[model samples]
Target: MMDARHDHPKLVLPPPTYPAVLFVMAWVLDQHLIPPFIDSVSSAPLLGAILVILGLGAAGWAVLRFMRAGTHVEPHKPTLAMVMDGPFRFSRNPIYASFFALFAGVGMIMKLEWTIVFLPILWLCLRLWVIAPEEAFLSSRFGSEYEHYRQKVRRWL
Candidate 1:
């Protein structure tokens, strides 16, 4: 099949790609926006590290669940089944939640105030451009089964 992403190239960035591109943007922003922190880093640097690890773990688990279900992990493709086990027990979008957590963790650990500032734009893009389409696709493909699961699980925890 022709790739679904080809149709809306500008709007539909995959969630995993966001941090890679935006981290560089955040670094550039940090250079012009603030003096390097001469002060010592905070305790939450460790907490931030933990969050990054946890976020990756969660995303990985969600992907594993999709693989186990024989469902396509990429939302652009039609999924074979609705995955409700693993991390899906809590959030409808564990992978996206992981992205948010990872982004926040990086900002906190790097002490880049501007990262936090632009975080919401990244979030809006993910929700509107990325996840929204995926959710709509699932709703259409899976119908009532997907909707009932959506009602049970919050989007993010």
Candidate 2:
């Protein structure tokens, strides 16, 4: 058997731990990035709260699955198993999606008017900086198994 650790794929991007910091910084700066003319929050208060609840719930669900499977949660490490249960069943990138929901939720909760633009930027960063590289790593390491999972689940819900 080919041990996963014996031939770990060469990761092209830096580990995601630092990007999380960048995300937080960007999250704060996002409020300032919006054009004064365009800054506006959604009128619906309940929707924001709901998004927060759902995002947190999904993140917790993914984390629980990861813990139960005994896989490393760090992006720098290669996961030993492909998880297909819990929130993962609904979205391949549940964590990222949850992050998005959380960001949007925070915006909604704070009524950060700039989030209309901020959310898309966050999504773009996560997709390009995080998800794309992650997908490539999974493909290189897991081969057809990852591909099969990719086919089975949407990258995001």
Tens digit of per-residue lDDT, candidate 1, span 1-157: 4255532223356666777678778888788867646226666577678888999999999999999998778754655678999999999889988987788788777876666777887788788878788777767666799899999999988
lDDT of each: 0.77, 0.71
Clashing residue pairs in candidate 1 are: none
After TM-score superposition, the amount by which residue 12's alpha carbon in candidate 2 deviates from its true location, in angstroms, is: 8.2
Q: What is the Cα-based lDDT of residue 34 in candidate 1? A: 79
Lowest summed-lDDT stretch of 10 residues in model 2?
A: 35-44
**Each prediction's TM-score versus the true structure:** 0.84, 0.76
Which regions of candidate 2 fall more than 4 Å away from where they truly are? 1-43
Cα lDDT tens digits, model 2, 1-157, are 5565643334445444433554465557655664333235345456778998998899888989999998866666657777889988889988888887776676667665455556677677777777877788778778898899899999998
Q: Which consecutive 10 residues in model 1 have the weakest lDDT in total?
A: 2-11
- Backbone clash total for model 1 is 0
- How well does candidate 2 score on lDDT at residue 8? 37
TM-score quality measure for candidate 2: 0.76
